[model samples]
Target chain A: MLSPGIMGRSLLDKVWDLHTVRELPSGQTQLFIGLHLIHEVTSPQAFAALRDAGGAAAGPPGHHAGGAAAGPLGHKAGLRVRRPDRTFATVDHIIPTDSQARPLGDALAEEMLQHLERNCAEHGIAFFGPGSGKQGIVHVIGPELGLTQPGMTIACGDSHTSTHGAFGAVAFGIGTSQVRDVLATQCLAMARPRVRRIDVAGKLSPGVYAKDVILAIIRRLGVKGGIGYAYEYGGPVIDAMTLEERMTVCNMSIEGGARCGYINPDEATFAYLRGREFAPQGEAFERAVQWWRGIASDPDAVYDDRIELDGARLAPTVTFGITPGQSVGVDEPIPSPADVPADERAGIEEALAFMALEPGKPITGTPIDVAFIGSCTNGRISDLREAARVAQLGTVAPGVRTFVVPGSQEVQRQAEAEGLPAVFRAAGFDWREPGCSMCLAMNPDKLRGRELCASTSNRNFKGRQGSPTGRTLLMSPAMVAAAAIRGHVVDVREEL
Target chain B: MSSEAKVERVEGRGCVLRGDDIDTDRIIPARFLRCVTFDGIGAHAFEDDRLQAKGNHALDDPRFAGASILLVGRNFGCGSSREHAPQALWRFGFQAFVGESFAEIFFGNCVAMGLPCVTLPRAELTRLMDSVDLDPQQRLVLDLASGTITSKLGTQAIAMPDGARRQLLEGAWDATAVLLAGGDAIDATADSLPYVRGFAA
Candidate 1:
């Protein structure tokens, strides 16, 4: 047991202690998972593994709960979904946002979805199927539906699960094997990471968004910098960010090598969760707020490490290379391979050659073949509103393909109600339904050969946008909107 | 698939990939992840990179054929928590990894599958990589009990969390049954928490 008063402790330390089920003999903490989120791409294999492990003594497949006793195969098909009430399922990664037709066009995708649907049905877990108006990127829907809350440990198959940490929770992504672990035992074996407080002092400039703020952080701290640490985002700048903005920041914490990231719960967090579908109601909500407030890092909290940044000085940043950490400000020239240390030159050269970029040239004015403004990173209503505002400035340029995919069905509904879709459509940006459309390009949406894109999605890695030789420059949604209009990378500030 | 599987030692030839932040997307392209299962994923490991390199990539190199120990640079496997990445490597015949560092989720996935992932300082890893490259058939042994990687040339101290080391040594890397054994504690913890109880104050 931990004494919060004996020593000033961080939010991570407090929340972790609360969720510790027991310490395993392996010297890892057997942390209880409060909420386990699963998607189509990752869950099928896990369920199959469970079925294989459950065997005949566990009963026939699809035998679960009360049904385990009634099935002809016998009373234990081994539907080992411990705490089904705590688990939620959705179809995202592989679902096509372009169509809502039953039995997906891709037979393989259809089969995967069927497996998930069947598994969820047998286990008595909730599934946000297509047209359910709840299906979306796992990270986006979790917070919107209020399944993500403060002082909870949230795990999902998708890497962007860190998005839930914006609610002042301990959230991280897990692999399918761990997903199986959670499904079978409702717990994960994990080692506690050291806490690092990243203080972003001062206010950001007019054109800079939360996306840029995160890009700036990743650029300063290399992709591997946070390997063994959890980032606690704070200071004046973070205090001023809205909940959605905070989500955008935390969503890419994985890109910076931190599996988990969080901001202290405040009135903004409480306000955002107050009336959501699953949040505690009435007096219970107020009591929950008190608990959330107490879990925040104490004033005298000790941290393993501390980092400070002047957010006011950050510009509209864009990644010009493979990793998110390889980025630069809009007006700044790309660093020459010769300028960096010898050990890093190879990586720089690889990026430059792959991106077909010349060192020392400013990234501004680089032509783009396509523009995308959606992903878990910047697909909320606020992101759409921001991009829509820029969309009103001008129509998309000739020969520059553009798409604006909403993060979730709720976000799409809100944007449509606000006429944001019409604004985008009029600007020549294809307004699409909710799903992670072009972020990883797993579905129908993809880039043609050797194309360059200005994207709002996370990860500018090689072939990330579907074309093996395609290039991606990641920026804020507004920047993506500006690029769509101009047919090249331009500062959103100038467009405004 | 059984809990009896242990990974105390991984001794085999080493394959070297010298790059930082080598991401999962490059390891196994998203296009290959459309399958319902991880079967045959090994053939597609580094699909795009191998295509671009025209069989010149380490995974494609004939000299390192059947190598089971992977030597990589810093932050190896740094994107996407897709277990498919490690599954691909495991299927491709890799049993252990020695790198300057590794992404947390990727490392955990490897551990869950009973693979041993250890780290070394950048210089030490470079030396191991260089020695292995000069003689592709060189054998390396990673012993969790001793916390060192040994080779014909020399032995170097390796670093991994003691907990992970213990898990590998004790064959308890399959965590489901172990965690499920503590059902009472899990329920007690869940009950004591306010959120699961609807925030009863």
Candidate 2:
């Protein structure tokens, strides 16, 4: 076992150094990507990029063998990807989360889904298709299946791919070209991002889950606060959280504008990964745990920046406006322009105007036409359990549409095994299949007209949930369930 | 693998969008993501905002209708990892964007698609935005070779990191091309990985 010396490095640096295959002539590192997770939305073009290269002599102009090197420095274009085990995919973004009926109503979505199926089949890549039962949100399936592990560098086309970092890996969301880059070659050329240590110490008060804690951090940091840095979350609060809770925290790293976010592996992380389908077995499992533990940051690891927050001070937070950063505690008021910093005032005002929210009005009791509990952020079983606890109390308020989407089929099965679905349905919630529903509205689950929603999803961007004028209130699932019951945004703490 | 794609400079009419942190969601809503290709998304660029403001959104304004060069405030394209955001802009005829700042992922995505995202000093950005917003017909020139955005506001030093600037001017962002070009080295790296064997993977 290795002992910590006086000088210590952050977990991100440790993972980054281990994953570097080689540094390119341009000084960029060729990061050896351990896992490449893709969805229907981003994989099509990447696969096309591959086929185009194979037929460079007789392909489209974009598919030229050597890319049109009209510039000073020539570029590389041919793709020779032969590794299939390293790639995994699923259909979540464009699939309906509630049902599996063939001949989907949206033909374009169906086409995209079918294209993904064909691409995966042709490539020999593992595809968790509609009937696989293993199918679910890419982020959810990866963790539950033991695919996301410590000491690995994972990349996905979706921004929320940062969720894997909870296991102490350097996971990040890459663009489609990078997706093709990884597919064609199991490496992503990249400059490393600096690290920012976010420390939230102390035990959380009752009713404040990991979701609230992350929302609080995003609130303080603002959306662009982490633009050029990777975030390392630690301290008593994060350390005390369950694996699912940790994932919920790291999921929104992209929303904070950070490339990725991670927590060092520990006993809890080992416990979560042990005995899983993909995790090493028997003695190998013990060896894997040892390696995972060895990768944790040293006691005195240095960081590019550090932020300290008191977890006890955070309340159930909700976004009152367009961006995730424009949030406040459920009990707090929609901040007036004068209250926010001068630079942020314009954005705050713009959000207020778009939301039809008045300054100084309490964020609580803002009418919500929809209450959705889904997305990679808060769609895990614990999220379902917490929301079900509230739903078990009472039926939903009349005329308020609500959905409870499990993050994965496995999660849905677990929720069903525990009768969570019955509790939600009894309370007038539409408990649906596991997929990213209402989160991005790629599926049929969506908001309509100028309806305002209380969402457990990560983003509250304009039209995030489908309707152009629809407003979103980002909060925890329990808070979303409470909102469904009350027909407006309300603190789950009071309900509890 | 190599690329012929290049962006030495961009010459087109300039338009101004006066907001910071304009995210990918705002640029191209998720509803438009169902297609196999990034076709027709250009028409729906800022579709949600354009609809919400009853066609009064900046992208909807008739004055900037034909503008191919977008001048934005800081932190443009802040949210989402979707390359569709830049692709949509490309389809909409955006050759380059000169903003006060850009999100790392958004800038990288743009660079991959051969779109130049350059930043300028706050004062220069203000002058450019005001000038373009006042006259949509103003021809704006973004010279990546010299790192300058020229218009009636004159040539102001556009701030782009040496690496990103090199990436754009050299057409080196075709990552798959670059990776494939590495060829045997990539295969050798794969062969050397401990967990990369038949079942180890």
Q: Which is the leading candidate under TM-score?
A: 1
Give a tens-digit lDDT track for model 1, residues A281-330. 99999999999999999998999999999999999999999999899999
What fraction of the true interface does each of the listed models get right, in terms of native contacts kept? 0.76, 0.57
Highest-scoring model, lDDT = 1
By summed lDDT, the worst window of 10 consecutive residues in model 2 chain A runs over A64-73
The regions of model 1 sitting more than 4 angstroms off are A1-5, A55-75
lDDT of 2 by residue, A1-496 (tens): 4465556877778777777777765567777888889899987887777666643532234422223341122323334344677888898888886676787778988898899888787667898987888999999999999998897889999899999999998897988888887876778888889999999988898888898899899888988889789999999999999999999999998888898999999999989988888877777777677777778988888888999999989888888889988888878888999998887889989999989999998988788899888889998999999999999888999999888889888998999899988898888899888888898888898889889998889988888888877889898888889989998887788888
**TM-score (all chains, Cα) for each model:** 0.97, 0.94
Q: Provide candidate 2's TM-score on chain A.
A: 0.94
Q: What DockQ do you compute for every candidate structure?
A: 0.63, 0.50
Displacement of the residue A469 alpha carbon in candidate 2, Å: 0.4
Task: In candidate 1, list every pair of residues with a backbone clash.
Answer: A58-A76, A58-A77, A58-A78, A59-A76, A59-A77, A60-A77
**Prediction 2 global C-alpha lDDT:** 0.83
